[model samples]
Target: MKALWVVGDIHGAYDKVRALLLRAGLIDFGGQWTGGDAHLVFLGDYVDRGPNGVGVIRLIRGLEGQARSAGGQVSALLGNHEVMFLAALVFKQGDPHDRLGFREYWLENGGQPRDADQIEPAELGWLAERPAMLRVGDWLLVHADSMVYLKMGGTIDDVNASVRAVLAHANPDDWGCS
Candidate 1:
């Protein structure tokens, strides 16, 4: 098995991440993960805080495909920021507009409002379907700290089921089994 390169919350700042990766020799001048092609595990929070949230997302999405093509895989776990932006982007019935100020939040955190129109529906849908947690060997990758024990189905499918339940509810207090 190739070495697993687990990354933490980026909070955008694509240029910084790129520079660090380059300095560390993880990626090349062409922006490819050429250092041993390790299994890259992204620990979420790709958007929000810092500039270029959309660029960060696109870069990771592009890397996901490239990593897979290179016989390694990229595990992109869903963070709370992703959930917040997704809720703001998609129509949520009664008060969808109330959640529209995520752009402001992004700005406060050093990000600019992304052109939602430029993002394909299918890609957004794929992002919406991302799992909240990923178990890599004995380690667990999650966005926010768990409030209580989450009763996932003892498998990847089970974890996704639990995450879907939480996302469907859209209540911060009701996340995990407390």
Candidate 2:
């Protein structure tokens, strides 16, 4: 809760994200969590559109544990790009529910199959488990600047629950368009 740092949409740019974190004293050059009791919040879109999406994920996930051990916290929120990536993994391809094909859609949106191929199970679970929204003090945080969160639920908890349910059910209609 103290010294909160929020970052938005890395889009697989590992160098930039890591640089910011290092510069902020959140992590060291070795990518260790150096900010004791400071919180780092990643606003998702960790994959797709660029190389090293998986690397970004690995950094965030690794930092999460390290920071927690050091009395700090790290949180990553789900973005539309993450949604597209997951949908691509699940449905693969073929337009279902009158939307673009999942795999093809992701590719068109700058998805990298290499990232998908190298993604570990823990990373996959971590990505899928990310919240779509959060509140830190007076600041309301969400990955995308969109009104779609409103339709999910009136409350943050409700909206996150709705998202989790959709993901759990793997409904093409619910997650197809991001």
Candidate 3:
């Protein structure tokens, strides 16, 4: 990797992400990430707090593939919003208008829904699979600070797996509330 482009919390700003990639000289007009062979590490928060959450997700997913094909790697980490969205998705199957509180939370925090209908089962499935953090070389990347948890591991995968396992159970606050 020539250079690693660490993107901050996008918060569903699809256009801003697009512009940064383009300005970085990576990716042509085709939405491909290609330049200086930089490894693109999106620091999560790709959804919620913007008008194009769905578009943002699709764009990043697409660019990850494209970047891989172009000899660069795109790693997207999980943020709190991602976790919230997943929680809402899981809750939605049991209740249609579920998470009114969650949606209001997003709105209060500056987010917009992409569509009420025409849901993409694939994207939702993907979100469920995202990890809590990403590790690259000696750097630890997470949507929010995880310094308190790093003592347990030297690798991002290790820490993420541990955190995710904790989040799997109910009453998530019990995990790191100490």
Candidate 2 residue pairs that clash? none
> In candidate 2, what are the lDDT values of residues 1-178, reduced to their tens digit?
4899999889999999989999999999999999999989998889988789999999998999999999999999998888888878878665464255778878899999999899988777778888998998898889877777777889999989888878776568777435
Clashes of each: 0, 0, 4
Candidate 3, run of 10 with poorest lDDT: 169-178
List ranges where model 3 is wrong by over 4 Å: 93-107, 115-119, 146-155, 166-178
How well does each candidate superpose onto the true structure, as a TM-score?
0.75, 0.93, 0.77
Model 3, residue 28: distance off in Å is 1.3
After superposition, the stretches of candidate 1 with alpha carbons farther than 4 Å from their true spots are 91-111, 115-118, 148-156, 165-178
Candidate 2 to truth, TM? 0.93
lDDT of 2: 0.86
Better of 2 and 3 by lDDT: 2
State the displacement of the C-alpha of residue 60, model 3, in Å, after optimal TM-score superposition.
1.0
Task: Judging by lDDT against the true structure, name the best candidate.
Answer: 2
Residue 6's C-alpha lDDT in candidate 2?
A: 93
Q: Give lDDT: candidate 1, residue 127.
A: 68
